[model samples]
Target: MESEALLSVRDLRIAFAGVEAVRGLSFDVRPREVLALVGESGAGKSLTARALLGMVPEDATTSGTVTLLGDTDLAAQRGLHIALVPQDALSALSPVHPVGDQLAAAVRSVARVSRKEARARAVAALDRVGIPDAARKARAYPHEYSGGMRQRAVIAMATVNEPDVLVADEPTTALDEERRDQVLRVLGEQREALGAALVLVTHDMDVVRDHADRVLVMYAGRLTELGPADAVLGRPRAPYTAGLLASLPEHDAPRRRRLPALPGTPPAPGTLPPGCAFAPRCPLAADLCHREEPEPQEVEGHLVACHHWAELPHPAVDLFQEKQHASS
Candidate 1:
């Protein structure tokens, strides 16, 4: 049976002058689901998320379809029901003004709320995201709060309108571990409270495992793999994905010979590797992988874009024993 997806991004591509940041990427986020667009920085995660919100840079040229509500095109809806928590909270907000007024403005812009009403809603939003003494904090400027508080304030402003989709690009980038967990919990709460789909774009694989219901892995501007979060991370098929999992700093992961890392940097946006974008870095790459770009196709329930996916070996990591070995 088909799932009830809130958005379906089909063949979405983005170009900036001579550079191609996103290349025909496609994915879907079900209503109230947390989908992780997982990748390294400069891997097109934010670009795609911004594309969804119609907030791509002025210098960028875009094509293909980003459909929200399963029918309404993102280009058409633009700002009505989509809100973005950008990568940098400090840069996204105004330093001179109190965070509350900005939150109020966001709410009033989307919904027919008065300034007083919006202020109340803003306080409630701040409170929802675990901001302390939200009413008092509302009067405080963004600079007055610490990095974590400011991040929460950003979340509050974005969700004040009860948007249909929340595009959170590294929402907890500058936060500490405790605050990060709190922010993740607040995202969960916001999802439950508003029944809105959450698209969390983060480079942290740990974050994906902790907060996401599904995962999409991008390599060199193209999606290399996508599946249910647990299944995808637990049993990654693509070599690039396997290497990424191996690179994960897990208490459960063994202290290995050396943590595996993809050798070369991700290709520049304007041009990617000839065949598989990750071929140069993938251990399992064959001659075919170097020449022919693999198309994303379903295998069982997951979608993978590597030709040698099935032939690849499960990475040798004694995870359970590794924890025991660590204690010993």
Candidate 2:
């Protein structure tokens, strides 16, 4: 484990019924930094985030060490040391209980506090997340709160315990653009206030560009690129990362210009390609790429997993554009 890392994940693997969903993965989350885990759906972003909090499903088999502040027992430390903000706020919150009561229960579960103190802390947490009239609003049920408010309350609940790490799985999913930004702002504020490391899992590149200090790009359940946000997003070394960026509609491009899209879907678990799972979809894949899996290695300033990373084009998005043009 790195000396400065708040949480360290090494060789993390999750398999379901002998089918690997998340392959060998390693990373470190430093204190007070946002590390964005990004990839398309079925890339294991959510599974990886859940694993950080020891929340993987019962039937799945997991291997790896997720150490937090020198503690390897994640299940015991969950909520007290690490917390999760699940994707669906409505489902995560109980409709039967008042929001404040739920938060108060969470506080009391971890700390030996009186009901009064717990309620006070819960209200304070709600207020911290900018829930207007938190004292009154916290008394409302999940159904009574608006979508945005429910999301904020979930954030408040996750942070009220003052965990050292927070793993949010697509926190802004299904939210409108304005509401998404607002929720991210609230999440950032809570992270700042708690001085916690955040592992944010989302498919949103725009969110990654705006909020992440570092980006970890996954493909077919394995790391394709990992580096500082600017370096990774701006000059992605891996073809998989480049392809993903190329597919995004550029702001300065013509509104009707078709975006370059990666040709194939991600391979289903248990049916991955022999060498590199992405080789079939990667435009730059060479014979060696098809014959041998590339482990993540330092290239320029980033860790990229690709046999041909050194040969990737400058302004990496052009790599995919040229491929698209050739195919057309």
Candidate 3:
């Protein structure tokens, strides 16, 4: 583990019965940095986040070295050093308890604190997340708060202990545009306030483009590309990465009536075919891709697992420039 890394994962793999969910994953997150895991649903994004906090489902088996703050084994130090903002705050929170009481309980679980002191911390946390009338809101049960407010409260509880790492799984999911931005802003604010490293598991490329320092693109239980956000999103090296961006409605080139899309859906987890999991759908897949899984290799300093990455042409930048020009 590197001394500078707040969290380090090496060859992490998880399987349910004979089917793998995450395969040979490795990554590092430095303090105060945001690493986004962007991919379609069932791409192992949530599983990876859950595994980081030792919260994988009971039916699964996992193996990997997850180190936090250099020496702490993440499995042993789950909630004490790391916390999770689960996808659904409504279900994650105790519906019967006052939101404030729940936040205070979280603080108490991680540290020795008096009830009065914990309550104070909880209120402060709520205020930090921009909840109006924080003190009063604390007394309300989860059902009383609106969805956005509940989500903010969940973030507050997750960060109240000032954990070294925070895993936010689809924090903006199910929110309207306004609420999505609000949740994103609060997450960024909280991460900065605590100087905590964040692993944002989301399928929203826009979120990744705006907030992430780097990105890890997962496909079919394996990493297809991982690099700086600009390079991966703007000039994707792997065909899969390019396909994802091209398929976006907003990325359609001028006058292009139909949006481009990858040909096939992701393979079922346990039923993954013999070779590269993405080969079936990848436009640039070659014979090698179907027979031998491509290993992550250095491509201009970034990592991409593609047998034909060198052959894949970077998307034309002028297409976007023209769109911007016309819109302006």
Top candidate on lDDT is 2
Between candidates 1 and 2, the one scoring higher on lDDT is: 2
lDDT of 2 by residue, 151-198 (tens): 999999999999999999999998899999999999999999899989
CA-only RMSD, every prediction:
4.1, 0.9, 4.1
Which digits, one per residue and each the tens of the lDDT, describe model 1 over residues 41-158? 7789988888888778999888888778765456556445778877688898998888889888877766786789989998999998888899999999988999888777887887
Candidate 3, residue 66: lDDT = 79
Task: Name the runs in model 2 displaced over 4 angstroms.
Answer: none
Candidate 1 colliding pairs: none
TM-score of 2: 0.98
CA lDDT scores, all candidates in order: 0.81, 0.92, 0.85
Q: Can you tell me which runs of candidate 3 are displaced by over 4 Å?
A: 1-3, 251-256, 316-328
TM-score per prediction, in order, is 0.90, 0.98, 0.92
Model 3, position 113, has a per-residue lDDT of 90
> Residue 124's C-alpha lDDT in candidate 3?
96
Report the C-alpha lDDT of model 3 over 176-201, residue by residue, as the tens digit. 88999999999999888888889999
